[model samples]
Target: MVDSVKVAGIQMEPKILEKELNLERCLDFIQTAARQGAKLLVFPECALTGYCFSSLDEGLSVAEAIPGPSTEAIASVCRELEVYVVMGLLEKSGNKCYNALAFVGPEGLIGSYRKIHLPYLGIDRFATPGNRPFRVYDTPVGRVGLNICFDVRFPESSRVMALQGAEVIALPTNWPKGAESAPRFIVHTRAYENRVNYIAVDRVGVERGFRFIGQSKIVDYNGRTLAEADVSREEIIYADLDLKATREKRVVIIPGEFELPLFEGRRPEFYGLICERGESVEC
Candidate 1:
C-alpha cells in the first residue's frame, strides 16, 4: 500500500516581475518544507511574477517556457531534497501567454498544466485560456492534479481530474482581499465531492496596486481542513495527508461518481418541450 504524504503550502509574497528573486524565494521555501518533513510543496499562482505585472509585454518578458529556467532551478532541489514541488509560472507559448504550473519531483520535471479559466480584471488582458480541462501528473507519491484560480469554480474540471485517479488536487491562486471565501469554498468542495485531498496556496501582500489575501490551506477528502494559515501573514503551512484513511473511506461511503450526465441520459421529449417554449434548457 502507498504511504501517507506530507505536503506544504508556501503562502508568501513575491517580487514583481523578477524571476531571480522568485527563484531564490522558492528555493528557500523548498528547503523550509523539506526541513519540516514535507514530501510535496505547493506555491501560489504567479508566484514568480507576483500577479498584476504592469504590462503584458513586461509579464511575457518574465514568462519562461516550461522546462526552461524555472523547472530547472527546482529540479536541483527535487534531486537534492527529494521533494515534489508544484509552482506557478507565467508561460510564454509563442505569441500567447498562459498562467501555468509546473510539477517537479526528485525524478526531474514531471508535467506542466496551463490554467484553463482566466479570471477577469487586468489579468484578462494578459492571460489566455488553456484548451485542456485537467492535467494529472504521475508522481512517486501518487497522481496529482493542477487547478488554477478560476478553474476550481467549474465543477466539471475538478470532477474530470478525480475521475482520472487523482489523489491530490493542487491549486495556485491570487485573490483580492475580501475574496478569500471563494477559494476556501471551492477547494473544500473539491475535496469533499471528489473524495481526494486538496491544497490551495495563495499570495500575500499587494502587487502592482492589487491587494492579495493569503489564507492558504490543506483539506482532507471528508472536507476537513487539517491546516490553514492566516490571511495577511507570509507563512508556510504543512500537513500529512492520510491516503490510507481517505481510500478506506472511499470504499465505505462510496463517493459519488466523478462524471457528468451523458446525452443518452437526456430527456429529449422534455427538452423539446422547453425549446417549444422559446427558452433555454433550464432556469
Candidate 2:
C-alpha cells in the first residue's frame, strides 16, 4: 500500500432532474482530476441525481441501482485512469430508495455507504433511512470510510469509523446557503478529534429556490486545511494525504506533561448512553 496519495474534491452545480447532464459533468470532472494526479477523487452529495426532491416518487424516478449504468460508466473511467472515486447518488433497491455513496476503484465497485441518519431537509426527508452499519473498507490507498452529508453532524458516525481504523473518511455533502460554519468548524473538529483525514465535497448553485454553499474542502489528520474550494464557484481542490500520519494517534504535548491517546483512552462504559434510543437524558 502507498503511504501517501493525492486526493481531489470536485465542487460543482448539478441541475435538478437532469441525471444525464449531471452524469456527464461528473465524468468530465473525474477525468480532469485524474489527469491532475489525484488518485482518489470525491464528488458532492447527489452528484448523479440532484437532491431536494418533493416526494419519494420523484427521488425513485431518477434513482439507479448501485452497480447499474452510472457506476459502470464510472468504473470504466477508473479502470482507464487507474484511480479511485467516491461519489454520491440516490440508490434504488426494489421499492426503497436511499441516499448513498459509492466507492469505485480501478478494479470495479468497491463498496457503498447508505446514509444512516436522515434529516428533514432535502430528499432525505422522503428517502428511506439506511439500514447498514458504519464500516471502513481496506483499499490500495488506506483504510477508508464513507459517510454522506448530515452524517458528519453526529460525532458517533466518524468516531465509529475511526475506531475501525479508518485513515480517511470521505464525506459527500450538499451544504446549502446559511450553513457556512459546517466546513469552517465542524469539518475540522471531526478531523482533529478522530485523527483521520476528512474530505468533504459539497455542491454549489441554487436548485428549486434553495441555494447550495460550495466551500468543499480536504482536511488532514492534524486538522490542517490542505485545500479548499471557492464558495460560489465550480472548482477542484487537491491535497496529498500521508496515510502513515493517521495511524499515529498519540499526542505528546510538552513531552509527557500533556499526553493524549485519542483511541486507546476511550471509556466505552460511560458512553453507552449515546446508543440509547427514544429517550432524552440529562447530562
The candidate scoring highest on TM-score is: 2
Off by over 4 Å in 1: 248-283
Q: Mind giving the per-residue lDDT tens digits that candidate 1 earns over 66-171?
A: 8887899899989999999999988888877888898899877898888887767545467888876576776777678898877788776877787777788898
TM-score of each: 0.87, 0.97
> What is the Cα root-mean-square deviation between model 2 and the actual structure?
1.2
Q: What TM-score number comes out for model 1?
A: 0.87
Off by over 4 Å in 2: 254-256
Q: 190, model 1: CA deviation in Å? A: 1.4
- Report, for every candidate in turn, its global Cα lDDT versus the true structure: 0.81, 0.92
Please write out the lDDT profile of model 2 over residues 1-283, one tens digit for every residue.
6688899999999887899999999999999998999999999999999998999999999999998899999999999999899989999999999999889988899999899998898899888999999999999978899999889999999999998999999999999887788899999999999999999999999998889999999999988999999988999999999888888888878686888888889889888889988659776
